[model samples]
Target chain A: MNDPKSSLTQVRDRIDSIDRQIQELISERANWAREVARVKGEGLSAIDYYRPEREAHVLRMVVDRNHGPLSDTEMVRLFREIMSSCLAQEDPLKVGYLGPEGTFSEQAVRKHFGHAAYGLPLGSIEEVFQEVAAGHADFGVVPVENSGQGMIQITLDLFLTSEARICGEVELRVHQCLLSQRESLEGIKRVYGHAQSLQQCKTWLRVNLPSAECIAVSSNAEGARLARHTDDAAAIAGAAAGKVYGLKTVADAIEDRADNTTRFLVIGRSLFPPSGNDRTSLLITVNDKPGALYDVLSPFAKRNVSMNRIESRPAHTGKWQYAFFIDVSGHIDDESLQAALKDMGPVAEQVRVLGSYPVALP
Target chain B: MNDPKSSLTQVRDRIDSIDRQIQELISERANWAREVARVKGEGLSAIDYYRPEREAHVLRMVVDRNHGPLSDTEMVRLFREIMSSCLAQEDPLKVGYLGPEGTFSEQAVRKHFGHAAYGLPLGSIEEVFQEVAAGHADFGVVPVENSGQGMIQITLDLFLTSEARICGEVELRVHQCLLSQRESLEGIKRVYGHAQSLQQCKTWLRVNLPSAECIAVSSNAEGARLARHTDDAAAIAGAAAGKVYGLKTVADAIEDRADNTTRFLVIGRSLFPPSGNDRTSLLITVNDKPGALYDVLSPFAKRNVSMNRIESRPAHTGKWQYAFFIDVSGHIDDESLQAALKDMGPVAEQVRVLGSYPVALP
Candidate 1:
């Protein structure tokens, strides 16, 4: 049998060797990043705007091996964030989201920015984008769609009208709670929540509280805070928001749909650094000719690129026409993506890049 | 082009033909099921035991060709119920579940049963199985695991001790709502809900209703009912339940986790009809020998089968030992399953089949 002391020493030595290797690798990477930052500061930009293609190529190489618990996709996500942070160190970004306190958008902001940038909260959605365009904030968070409620038209309209680049995306699960100020279930008559919250719990409200008048507020957290002040009122909000507002939850898990989820968008003035599994959003207006829309999109389909979202909005330029907002897989730098966009040019009257960013996964 | 009226007529005729074909297919399936039931009934007295192998083969055929918006795995679930209902027509099956009203278990029962059977709500989990054994209920529903709180030990303990067959399973999303009688935010003092509901919203309650006393009741619906009886007290429950009990929603969506989901089990005396993706639960007691547990599970891993849940309970023989409840994928009738169970005979002091049922997807 091996001696106990020897076995313990041997294990510790192996761990120390692994730690030394990891530390060396990390230090080397940091040095390279700093060098790149200095080069960019000297007006010698090292970034490859077309780097997503190169990133995808690198990941495919690792995935084809299938050697470990870390899947190719996972490694790519980690590396993408690492590289993004490193590059952004040359020019740090600031983001604005809808909040004074807890909100889903705040979470989205954190998710997109990571620890690389500062997140600021504004009073309204318009203020969020304004902060970005006015250079107060580098990015903005806005709700795009909810699983049960279809698209958020306000965000789509903003994209159409605002010049801020759509830089990134995030998805958050929506859980609502009934919060109250009262210690007892006595004489409570008022309910408050965002309009969307009231709609999601419509079926339940119709049968249970037929006589109570429902009121819509700006946010669930605010509603909860209001409920804290009013003995007869309760707020409908996410459990986290309720906690922040210090509202007592009377009921929970109240969304009409069991799998209720919400998707949010991040907007900035600049494009995101390449992430392998990236998606680009664009607003395009095709020619009036029949099949023109098909012609503009056919190049993507033929190349097997997938489109995630497609929506049409009125041109709003007194043209009596509509423009399509399309979100498609593959960043603008990919060869196929470039070709597809090039092919689309002839058919499109206007084509605007909303920006490309990393994909969010469950 | 042909006349518009004639084209419309032809399209309508084609739609009618498709509808007729659908009806024919449904009838043919029903007839085959009835024939299977008849054959089984005739053989019941001649054969004391059911042929699980044959049942499994039939289910495998159904699963193989499943093209689905709901995956092939999810398709097996509905087919399992249809087959179970057919099998039950030959001999009545008793089911039990925790009840009074407005519990998620009730929804699980309806979902698994498909509105064909009567669901009896028992006073307790023990009563649910007792009713099944006494021929009062054919199956029982009990919450097993919650996303936020982990396992419901009482339910686990019952599975560890009881001999009831777990014939099927289902998952349901739970939502909570705050209910009240008042129309305006005025004098409310107390809040009511199930203990777990109150716990989930503890953070929310502290901030919103710091002065309000949170009281735990038997069920969310019960809380609502109680709240309805009092003027200032509010109840926490499902939105539907709140409406049914005539309570106003003061707050909603109060769970800590936004993606909160619950998994429930359906227990009956009879074995369930096979579904391709089945999970068989077993409670095992070993002599506390080294490698004893490993030996029992190794066979499954060797056969490429995955185990989903592993729980331990006191052996209840007034000893310091424990029994393990394991849930593994694969129908018990499968060859790999048979081999694993057969090999387990010598290693286990006692190996009892808690049940083999279709895994429910939320």
Candidate 2:
């Protein structure tokens, strides 16, 4: 019986059978999710199906229980996509991110919600926040900070005005590639990249394409797109973004910094229940006096709540006063955080709890 | 006194006079800086002339003493440029940043060192460190984090390997603009931008120039370069960067978020003395256990060191373990911080101080 077919064909047939089984199981899962949605929404005019804490718990389980050839992160990604499809069957989680099809913001959305969720790539972080706030999208993804670049002031400033709450956070490592339609670097008249990527790959492009004009594009994907149309142009973008246009990689990982990572926030209407490993963000305005910052932070010190991050932003338009964005370990529901928040009132002019959400696991 | 003089010309004349006075004062200051360098270098063949603490004090004084039409930040910028010139006169403070002249990293270098110093735009953050380590440059500037984007991982990762210390930090607000040599957006068939800028201006571009093929470039200045040559092309970049190439602003402040601030670090061979308002950074690898991070951070909490930021990065390849980058308030010289550092060693597998530098005053 084994002699009738080659190993390659037999393996291919096995893979097809496995895919069919996987699809069947996913369909069953979707059916259950839909049934649960119907049961939960019976008497309600509006339904809230997405649960952050539950999803976090499930993802943690996926990582914890994973015993495979695939890495835990890789496993988590696959499971999340499956969950995304299941959630979509109940009610598709409409998400917004900065988009023109192939930017990193879109990647963040896909990473967090999976491919089954709808991705609406808006023009700006503000638009993203607005769509979520206006209830057009269930949640919006926005870049909060870059490990290399620090806090995105615009996103922080938007937090001051927008009521959208931080629902979750995710990080993506940025690996830039130089992609073009041309087979070789010869006859290349120009190299296009994102400003950050261009800045990241400044040395490489300069040394390699000395005579070619280097241009800054909006996104690496956009660079790939431009490279696709222009005969003499090459683009610097991520492998995933570059792959979309079928552009060939002329140079891979052209970024100057080897570990360029970006942190993104998922913003929605309300904060979810806490995940065990969590972070609480607070925006506080300090008093106009010396040692103002010290006074604001002493409460957390007293409570021994491990602070994750503290960044100062210029308060209103052209003013000298500052507001501090503080990230501290522990959910807001935790006892230490409750005590700390109580004492924080007097020291700060204003204190707003951004949210308490699960910390990103790798 | 004012014959051919309009109000604008008279003001410009007054500015010229003030500028001449400034030049004289700056020349005198440069002489003093050189004298200090000579005095400090007297006995030693190898000399460390940069004083982060002293510069911080001076900047603080500039902010404190200003009673002005110009804001404190604006005043510090002017003084920093002047002081940069003075420092250059002493050692020519050769500084490196990821640049092709017009990116924000170059702005950061100019902001910290002033225009008088030689600006070397290297290819990457690693190259910046290499130049500084090799003594080709006195110091290198790298972006640590952005308000929106979070921490730049490459810079953080470099700290794990580099001996470079954080000497100082500065923040610059990102204000992206649409620039062109073209008369109007009407005939604009192509819009060029950097990735970050493109992402920042996504909504605006989509709404304003929907049909235009948005291209990604290496730097906004590079985009300005392309727009200068191409008839139908417009570039999105910083105003100052665009101005260098004489590109006209078709639309200013096109960024989605208003407070897109980027934080940059001045990295060098040594750490700075206490500047009163200081922040100390550390690289730590935690032991494998539950709440391992908590164990490492408890010491800082106990000492009331006021933790600033904490971020986790995967420790080596194919490993589930992580290494953390931490920032805390107070200099290493401070009593509490010194105590905290002493206690941190036992709890962590490895602990390395990145630097103790003055907290940036926005």
DockQ for every prediction shown: 0.01, 0.01
| Cα displacement (Å) at residue A162, model 1 | 53
Candidate 1 lDDT over A1-362, as tens digits, reads: 15644553453344333323332333344344554334334542222221333434333443454332333333333334434444444444556777642356765664444433445656678878776787656567898989778888878888778898876677777777777776544556888889989999887667656676789986564566577677888778876555434467777777787778888987777776566778899899765678877887898898777899898888775474578889999788888878888877777888998888767543
How accurate locally, in lDDT, is each candidate? 0.64, 0.73
Candidate 2 residue lDDT tens string, B322-345:
698999988888999889878887
Q: What does candidate 1's lDDT look like per residue over B1-362, in tens digits?
A: 15544554453344333323322332334344444434344543211223333434444554554333233333444444433433433332334567643346766775565323444555688877666665545457888888777778888787666678887667777777667897633567898988988887777677767788889876664576578779988876777655434467777777766656788887767675566667898888876668878987887787776888887777875465668888988777778877887888888788888888766643
**Per-residue lDDT of model 2, residues A1-362, tens digit only:** 24423543443344333333333344444454554455455532112767777677767866665443334555566556556655654345778788644456876887888755666656678878877887767788999988766889999999888787888899988788878888888988988877887877787787888898888876564576578778899988777545445578888877666777899998988977887888899998875689888888999999999998999888883355788899999898999999998998877888888998888856
Candidate 1 residues lying further than 4 Å off, grouped into runs, are: A1-362, B1-25, B41-93, B101-103, B134-138, B159-161, B177-190, B203-212, B217-235, B239-253, B257-259, B270-274, B288-304, B334-347
> Given the true complex, what DockQ would model 1 score?
0.01
| CAPRI verdict (incorrect, acceptable, medium, high) for model 1 | incorrect
Residue B160 lDDT in candidate 2? 74
Strongest candidate by TM-score: 2
Q: Locate the minimum summed-lDDT window of 10 residues in model 1 chain A.
A: A44-53
The 10-residue segment of model 2 chain B with minimum total lDDT is: B15-24
Residue B13 of model 1, lDDT score: 47
